[model samples]
Target: MSEPIRVVVTGAAGQIAYSLLYIIANGEVFGKDQKLVLTLLDIPPMMGVLEGVVMELHDCAFPLLTEVIPTADPAVAFKDVSAAFLVGAMPRREGMERKDLLSANVKIFKVQGEALNNHAKKDVKVLVVGNPANTNALICSHFAPSIPKENFTAMTRLDQNRARAQIAQRLGTDISNVKNLIIWGNHSATQYPDAANGTANGKPVTDLVEASYLQSDFVTTVQKRGAAVIAARKMSSAMSAAKAAADHIRDWWHGTESGRFVSMGVVSDGSYGIPKDIVFSFPVEIKNKQWKIVQGLKLDSFARSKLDITTKELLEEKEEAMAVCNGN
Candidate 1:
């Protein structure tokens, strides 16, 4: 067998971690043939829960899982890791302002970024799954100057997958028939789910779904699906979020099959007029271990307006974070 690939996951005591570790242990994310050594990181107070998770991992007796290490220190957790998933963060509590939430998460990501830069392997790819993921990813990328900005991405695949599944169900077709869906801008409520460029079995999605529904209801449904899930389950989203993380890393490290571009919140390079240095989701195609923004697709006026709104919101949050860091 080849040497084990080291993966570090932050927030190891959280619900998503519970859902994610099982898949990783079974080698579903990386592949069945590859062996894995997982380093699970959590806060000191959460170490007990992480320990419980470790015990469960052992119980599974997965052949592909070589070892599981749980720790409270980012340095220890990220040491020599091939990939780091930044899933831990200060969630937005009730009565908290957006600025306050961003400030708290910024501190958490900053330390993780420095640790990853100092201790992780040279090729570490980071996926930020925490709330306000795009801003948090930007903070981490800024702190880890040594790591390429493109290597730090926030999860938007969940939204993309949700859009595809919804479209598939509406059309009474399998998900395989859905293609070219794009989740643009931030991963939050302001995200634009573009079916304008999407297709179902080579036919434009807009052709199947009514234009009125597409213009109003479909976009709202995709953007607010998380809230709906929470309302129904009376719990936070865990399983689907974990699956999205896996899908994202798998496609990135492996490759997106022909004719598909995954949506990811990567640091913007002023593509599509988005401001530079902000982590914004775009329709991206991955090849040869790098992601390039999918260009030349004309956005209708409505899509353009929606993208602007989301990008502006992200920029404002980033500015507030910078002001706080500067003690303004």
Candidate 2:
């Protein structure tokens, strides 16, 4: 059997991590036969709560899970880790300004990033899932100077999955049939759920559904689905967020289908004219442990207009996050 690799999860006592840890231990994110040790992190005061969560993981008796280590020290939790999930962040309270929220989380991510850079292997894949994730990832990457920028990602797979589900339901087809639905730009509502290249069972979505719905309703629905869930459930999305995080990591590790793209927020190389140095979600696929942007998709004028809006917002977010990180 291959030696076990260590995987780190922040916010170990939080709702999303509660849903995600079981999936990881069950070999959903990492495959069966690969052994794993879960390194979990939370605040010192939350250690008691984290101990109970660890007990539940042990109760499952997953053969592949060799150990569960919970710690409040960032250095101890991140040491020698292969992959890390930055899931904990300051949630926006009622009446909190966007700048204030960004500033608060920037402080948290900076410390985590430094710890990872100092302790984890240089090749660790870092996925940032907290709100304003793209910018949070950018700030984290900035602090983790030893790790390559390309290894840092923000979760936009949730948006991609939501778009695919909406398309599949509208067409009354299985979700498996939808491929490569583009989520251009930030993960927020400004994201463009472009069905321009996606297909339903090898048929172009345009051929299956009305262009009006794809252009207007489909885009808006995928963008606002998060808020709609909160309204209906009285809580922000937990299960779906956890599921998407699983899909994001699984696809990134296992590879996507041939001739298909998925949305991931990776560092910009000026693709699609998005500004360089900011982490922006683009259509991409992973191969040989690396993710490269999908190239050569032509955008119509309407698509370009929406991309402009989101990219502008991301650039603004980048400015705010960087300022906080630099203590400007």
Candidate 3:
């Protein structure tokens, strides 16, 4: 067999990682033919808890999971890894502002970014799944200059999945039937779940759902789904978040079907008039393992306004992250 691919996951003891690691071991992320070595990292205080998580991983006896390394050091965790998931960050506590959350997580990502730059493979793909995800991604990418800028991204896939689910439910079709939908700008409540150019089973989405609903309930529901999940369960959304991250990486690595462009939070190149410095979500297609932003979609006035709100929020978050990262 070929050498096992090294994968590093931060917050391995956290709920989302707990939900994700088993599926990845089952060859859900990497193909069944490939072997994997999982390197798990968390805070030093969480080491004992991480030990039990490692024990659980061993108990599963997955054939593809040949080795498991648990550590409190980012350098140790990220060394030579092919992909690293920056999933561990401080959650937004009650009464904390978005700026406060972004500031708090900045240091964590900065340290991880430096470790990844020094120890991880230059081609490693990094995904930031923590709260204030898009701006946290921008901060990480800023610190990891050795890694390819395009390889660093944040999780907007969860927002996209929610949007597709709402679309499919309303149209009475499978979620797979919803194609080409876009989640524009940040991952927060200001995000716009756009179906203007999307399709339902090869037909224009407008033909299947009313525009009034698309711009009203569908947009609001998809944007606020994360908070809704939290309110209903009294905990953050874990399983669905894990599933979305899995799907995001799978499609990125294996490529999506023709005519489908999923939403990904990538560094902006001023596309759709978003600022170039912040991480922003855009509709993109993956080919040759490279994600290329979809171009030439015309956004009418309403779409423009909603996108503006989210991008502005991202820009503000970027400012706060920079302040914390630079020790201001």
In candidate 3, stretches whose alpha carbon ends up further than 4 angstroms from where it belongs are none
Better of 1 and 2 by lDDT: 2
Q: What's the C-alpha lDDT at position 259 in model 1?
A: 71
RMSD of each: 1.2, 0.9, 1.1
Error of 3 at 79 (Å): 0.3
Could you tell me how far off, in angstroms, the CA of residue 223 lies in candidate 2 after the best superposition? 0.9
- Provide the lowest-lDDT 10-residue window in model 3: 319-328
lDDT of 1 by residue, 1-328 (tens): 7789999999999999889888777887778888999999999999988889999999999999999999998889999998888889998877999999988987898899899889988778899999899989988887888888889999999999999998999999999999989988998999999989899988999889998887788889999999999899987789999999998888888878777898999988888888898999998888877888999888888989999899889989899877766662
lDDT of 3: 0.89
Provide the overall lDDT of each model, using Cα atoms, as 2-decimal numbers: 0.89, 0.91, 0.89
After TM-score superposition, the amount by which residue 263's alpha carbon in candidate 1 deviates from its true location, in angstroms, is 0.3
Clashing pairs in 2: none
